[model samples]
Target: MNAAYAQSSVTLYGVIDPDIVFVNNAQTGRSGGQLTGKQQYSMLDGTTSAYFGSRFGFRGVEDLGGGMSAIFTLENGFNAANGTLGQGGLLFGRQAFVGLSSASTGRVTLGRQYSSLWDFVSPLAIITQWAGYIGSHPDDLDNIGGTNRENSSVKYTTPVWNGVSADAMYSMGGVSGNFAQNQVWSVGVGYTGGPVRLGVAFVDAFDPNISMFGATATAGGVTTNNLGSLGSATTAQRNPVIAGYASAHRQQIFGAGGSYAIGHATLGVVYTNTRFVGLGGNSGPNPFGYSGSSTITNVEANVGYQVAPAVTLGAAYTFTKDDGPNNQGARYQQVTAGAHYLLSKRTDIYMVAAYQRASGTNSLGQAAVASVAGLTPSARNQQVVDTIGIAHRF
Candidate 1:
């Protein structure tokens, strides 16, 4: 087999990240906004990117005459510590696509893929990009870190032209006779000139509630007073804040980010607005207990420095606000810091920490708990986490 593959070049690559983590005020339940009063210590598994979720993929490229090429990639994400699948247990959870490329034009791929907005703008997110997912805005609610992946999707990415590039993507909902149901569409544009780069992206997703809740329902006469009679299944969510709005008919996000490099330091800022529409209707609880439309706005800024040849440091802060019906809303303030030490080109060690505070009520009128992206909700209104991990690329 080794000799048989001599003429072909295929590479396998991935990153494995694991961390020892400590959390203060971790939520004990899956949903319902209940919190624990004690601090918790544990490990960050393959489900999260404490340093980075472990992943490996195979990729191949073949020249196809003048300025063209054939390419394919099959990637999977997993928990580095437990050796389990990530991204909801899909086999090729991270990515799987095949396409042709042209130097003069662009590339097109069809498969499950990230939205254009996420692909183009995620790297500019100072918190998620450098400080880790624990630094992400509340719940990673806007997906500014590209947490949501689209299935049955097609994407096109244009070649850079005068430091500018563009991307577009559409995902099929796969619901017969309902083309837009659970569908996702996005577009992004970026400009990179010297040390300064900027990106703007927009994303629209239909039937967000159905996608998040894993079912479709018609709210017949669910109201506030009898909400407790619906039982626990509908309110079973990973995050209470997001669960509250799981009844939303649709979701939309607008994101913009920019970064500048000066000397050994890079400074960046990212902003996003996310809206959940058509909630608070007469919808019976299907999964989440409450139904209410809401909007989340986030702003973040960060800076990174190469303090030494093998060492780097970064810090970021994010502010988030939620506006919803019945005046049930919340605000979050988060701060994070991290340091990375390079041991080799494909290996590095890092330590990161984050702290967040929350205020006001969540979707179910429960005290808003501080929860970082990719992590569990807090039992109280504030939370802290710290991790140390190593990552390897191969």
Candidate 2:
């Protein structure tokens, strides 16, 4: 082991991933208007997070003696194609945390970081670690709805014993009057031995709401305002915030996953269930009283085979089903396959293809909302995307 500042070390690490992509049934413009209909198209890349999501980070560790050490990491996510922050313009959108660790005790960290759900289950699901196009759930429901990464959080991890370990985290709301609003909590355990690894976790989110508009009006036969609609209705519903208070809502997530290695092949499987319940009155347009409950279940599987010391072939699939009040139920499925060739231990090239299909009833029963341009209730739509990219880590 390297000693503290006596042997202090600082390293710069980053990955620059950019990919060219082809999509079928892609809307043309950012406006929901019908600029271009379903057709094959090609682009510079990053359909999902822009290939490698260019990022730079600094990580270091210092020995504090007596079996204790101090560690820190500061990472930022950016769009390589456009040179911009990745997560809603947050500077350290990916992660920013500092912590202390003990060889005999455990580790404690604080800051914006990935939640237990992602830390535990994502490894088993090829999509989360790779990209949204392949492993992502329909609309990223599994990852985001369960609070993929949190802000203002404190986390703890137990020292591994015989390949078994545990972790827990709690997030502060940062709100004055309401202590629980927008807070989050999570706990998990994992075990890895020989050729098998398994983990389980649970997470809860107080309130989280985000939105994105469609590019075109009728790419998947669903018509909506070119700028996308916002409200407490339909799939765009968000938790309501009090007049002078913060939003009040809650989410619970439970997941389990495992992976096994066999010869030169590895296989992984994961299952997650998330529940959301509204706590406040409708802040946006309350077409159906606003307060509602929803549950989402996700299952994913992956397989990877090492073709050579520097090459790997993999395939993955994910299924998601949403059930809720006000005709908000929907089903989403995705299939992905890809391959990677390592240029070195810290660099690689990859090619991946993905297909997504969605079927369900619209939240608005009448389907007459101007946002949805004559979109039929309970329709099925599909999208196909292919990507080729390279990533390097240092």
Candidate 3:
């Protein structure tokens, strides 16, 4: 390059993860054929192991003088297996935001960004660390895995104050006449002191189908029409755990979690509650004919040990329960184990396995089926997955 900027700097960063996976008791033939139960073996691009997803991006910072700076990030998520875009094909779907920061104050940003839960509480969740995608809390009902993002939003984060920090976000509903039709808001707080880390967060969305899960490439890109069909708004998700409740008039999530580190080993635990209220005809077909509300509660505990300088082992167990209208209840239990070996500073090899069992009535008002996030739903009440992968960053 010929140009030079003295007070500005930009850096390029990316991660690529590819894995071979095995799934059992999965349903197949969704493209117009007899859907049958079968075992599947395939290669996945990213988001299964090592990292959340395969992505590349440019992040830059410009000194504005007096300990202030202008900052921005543009990230793109892509499938390493097929070389296609992830996150609904948006060029910078993973994250795209610009903001100003101050050393004494905080920072404010606008554009597509993460929710406070994603920023604060998610880090303490096992699914975000080593539990893998399949280890998500029964379809990631509370979004602790950050399966969704907020669009057309403004976010504020506070500078750490005596081992504590906080953030908040608000997303515009964008409806001309209905100011709260699809609006979303969230808040979170975190604390870090010595070997202890703690976090808590809460999020509420009006018409979550449109304001949250609907913000995808195939889902019409974050609309304000609460009257739209839920199926159309949540086409990106196949997990039935919460899909049936997408048409709910409101959705709320609360999560609190923390981790404690002792030498080379760490122990973590998290609890989350998610609610879908006012389920009725505001959207499309109510498959289960749900008329009232539904609630899901989850708890997870995990431990990780650094066996060696370059080797780590982790395991987690999660329990989830759902209570819906008409006294329907579903329950799920899962266990996950994984190990990662660092080949180099920027590359690693990993193996992970997870198994889950389900019972009772699911949100669809049918027999509960095991459905791990990022994989096909099981034909029965039990499912298993194993993955071997390699991840690299640059």
Candidate 4:
């Protein structure tokens, strides 16, 4: 093999993280399926790690003469404890995309993929950094954690110019006779200069339950055509933050974030606005009896510090509020703190904790309850979680 022809390569990578966790005010069912609150302790996989989820992936690149290349990525999410597929049990559910790239031009990709908001703006959000899964806003309604992905999508990214870049994505509805049904689109712009980074993004989707938030694909590369399983008021484990609006016909999200580094410390702030429009209009049962539109706002600030070469610390605060039809709403406040110590290049030990408080009315038309993104909603208005974990990468 000549050296010139050896420009193609494929790489394998993965991460595994396991944790012992404690949660207070967890809701559980009693003997007769009665709902009651209790404190629980358990071992979980990846949810408390610095990366948020455990995953394995393969990425490849092939040179195509000039300054262009062919690229592809197949990533899988899994639960380390149970050896089961993550992301609703779909293989390669984290990401699966193939595309072409040019040094002077840009890149375009197709397949199941993340939205522009996740790619560009989330980097500055606390959840993308040390805050990890426990820091998500309410039910992660804004998709800041990449929990929601688009199917049957096409994406384009521009080459960086003087530390500035932009990208756009569109997901086809794939429905006969109705091109706009289940459609999703997004756009974002980012800037990186010195120790400062900033981004802004917007997303719009029709029938969001099927297009983005609830989109599900199979191992055979087929996506679900209808709204998947939905949460209802009677569902003991369902999050109350935004469950009532599950039948929303459309959804819009806009967000902006920035980070500034001052030597060993970095400060970040983010804000997002989300709207669930035309509820009770989708092709699913409206169990929560929601109508019209509901609006949500989230604001967060965080700081990370490198106290030593192998030690890092982080803290964050977030406030989320929802304004629904006829002024119905809920409010949430959360605080998180974490510490990490690197044991080696590919391993680390960490501890993270968070507490949340809620008030007003939840989407279930009942009293608001605290709920973290990965955990079940609490039986009361306050909840607390603590976790200690170890992570390894290869």
Candidate 5:
């Protein structure tokens, strides 16, 4: 072993985000006619985690000499509010990866990692950079496909050149006999100069089975299928008749953003568009089809000003629209204002408020229920939320 190789360091990092929230006309349970049997409910709801759905991670690099280095990271997400693992009870839910890199050839890493869509588009939006609920496009369609993350992935990121860079990732199914099920791939490119940035990305998932409200047949007879029982079956068995719906699942996203400084204030703007096709499944006597092409467009603008050396004030507005086959469509608009006070470089206190309104038809043409998967509602049958919180990173 070389003397230089023995000198290596590992670091720990995490963030805490907790907040108080209020929702108007909230439904207690899942959709469908049996919705808690209650008309509406309202209460003080915690928006973020109590402490922070915080994450702890370890990262290290070893010098192999000759300009070569080996690196790895293991990150876990925990609910600071209740001290439980996040991401549906998966350990190291945030990320886990190992890789090798060189000054000459960029880096190649293998493990669970963020897709290129989020890496390229998230930073461009003020809502995403500040408020989690507000920053994401309806359901995070522009960020990483609505709460879905790639697993068993191999990624490559090229070093920056002339303010431009690129990345590609492929997720493996890891199914022994069947190879193509639950696989995903993505590619993206970005450029940044001054205060302007632009990005483009594409994502494709093959036979990525998803669960929906439907029925399944068993030896006993027909039964209402829920997520629990559906998880026990294979992709082929879960929605056998609609298997074609899962084939060639794809999404494409493109965005542009920029900021300009003026005196003590900076103004920013961002725009994004996303397209989805061939998703959802239903196979039975009562078949409900959710597969179709859809388009989502989002636009946002904001201004930030330094109130004092330690205090910053910001305000932003966002608009989103979704158009789908048939009459399934939705529109959302939001306004947000907040202030941050820096107690130290790594610690801060902040307060923010956002108001959102949505209108449209749900998948089933239910007038009261607006079909927007994630966003603020306009009425009781719609979705609306107001949140205030604080975050600290270390």
Candidate 6:
């Protein structure tokens, strides 16, 4: 490992990922009007972190000898397509933290960072790693996509032992009076052995209305979708897949995933359970009429193959089920395919496609329609999306 950094090391790193995408169906309607089942064909990218966030960062390490060291990282998320800051325009929206490490012990860090849950399950999930947020579960309700980071947090990671390691984290809500108002806690563990990797993770958030949806208790909740309105395709940001579920007062998630490598091929699968608690209160002005709580289960299976030294191919399938009030549930199914070609060690290009269909009552008790993880929810029950992009890291 380079003999404990013979010299102090500071490095600059970042990724620029931009894509042009098209959608078959993009939902739109007048405010509080009716649903206008519409189809959209336009150029789209992660203007709102749609997938594989584009970011840049600076990190450094100072070796103290005796198997000890100090480290720090400052990263920023941005819109590579338009040269703008992301993550609510924070200077270091992606991450900002410092910590100490001991070769024989572990590491302890403080600042803004991704939850332990993310460190665990992301590697085994297709959307989180390759497809980016576009493949996230409905609404990214599972955090397999949006807001994957936390602020005012402390984290710990145990030294790897026999290919096994564990991590835990806690985020202080920063509320003066209500200490627990927006607090969050997470834990994860993983094992990486030859040709195989396995992991499981969990997270709980208090006062999810603001923590997840970026709204206050009074102003929290999703806006009412048009009942039956339609619109012509334009350059409008699509709605979240499960917008109505935003009213959830609290959020909880549990997930497990694993990958196995076989020769030139790797196979993986992941399962996640996400829930929104006490929706009645946080539901925005036009709540989804859901009382009590709601739950969603997502299951995915995928395969990756190295067709050549610098070329790869992948395919995947996902199944989602929503358990809403009174046992009225909805169902969604999706198929995905992609191709990636490496231009160099730090640069590559890709093309991806996904199709989805939905049925049953949605989060707001309306007819369910297809919604891809990254694109807008569809007015009808089916939607398709395709994108071509290039990513460069330095």
lDDT of each candidate versus the true structure: 0.73, 0.59, 0.81, 0.82, 0.56, 0.74
Q: Give the total clashing residue pairs for model 1.
A: 5
Position 32, candidate 3: lDDT: 36
lDDT of 1 at 80: 73
lDDT of 3 by residue, 94-178 (tens): 8999999997999999989999998888888777787557667887788888878888999999999999999999999999999
- Tens digits of per-residue lDDT, candidate 1, 1-394, equal 3543223357988888887788776654434533344567777652233334778899988877777888889999887778888776768877898888898989998887778776667788854556667766777788775566777888999999999999998888888997878788899999999999899999988876444223322111112321331234332224555556655678888999999999999999999999887774322243444455678888999999999888888988899888865656988899898888899988888888888988988665667778776665676788888887888778
Tens-digit per-residue lDDT, 1-394, candidate 2: 9854544566788877666666554433322422223444443323332133567899988877888888888887776766867655668767899999897899999997777776677667765444433445554444532224677889999999999998899988777997876678889899999999998998877654311111122211112231132332123211111111111255677889999999999889889897656724221223334356667788888888889998878887777776645445666677878877889987777887777666663233222111111111111256667677777666
lDDT at 201 for candidate 4? Answer: 97
TM-score of each prediction: 0.88, 0.80, 0.92, 0.92, 0.77, 0.88
Model 2 whole-model lDDT (C-alpha atoms): 0.59
Error of 2 at 67 (Å): 1.3
Give a tens-digit lDDT track for model 4, residues 29-92.
3334344678989888876667887899999999998899999999999988779998888798
Collision pairs in model 3? none
The prediction achieving the highest lDDT against the true structure is 4
TM-score of 6: 0.88
User: Ranking under TM-score, best-scoring first?
Assistant: 4, 3, 6, 1, 2, 5
Error of 3 at 307 (Å): 0.4
For model 6, how does the per-residue alpha-carbon lDDT over 183-265 read when each residue is reduced to its tens digit?
88899999999999999999998766565544531121234432223233232223434556655667898999999999999
Poorest 10 consecutive residues by lDDT, candidate 1? 217-226
How many collisions per candidate? 5, 9, 0, 0, 5, 11
Among these predictions, the greatest TM-score belongs to: 4
Q: Report clash pairs, candidate 2.
A: 17-52, 29-215, 31-226, 32-217, 32-226, 46-50, 127-135, 223-373, 224-371
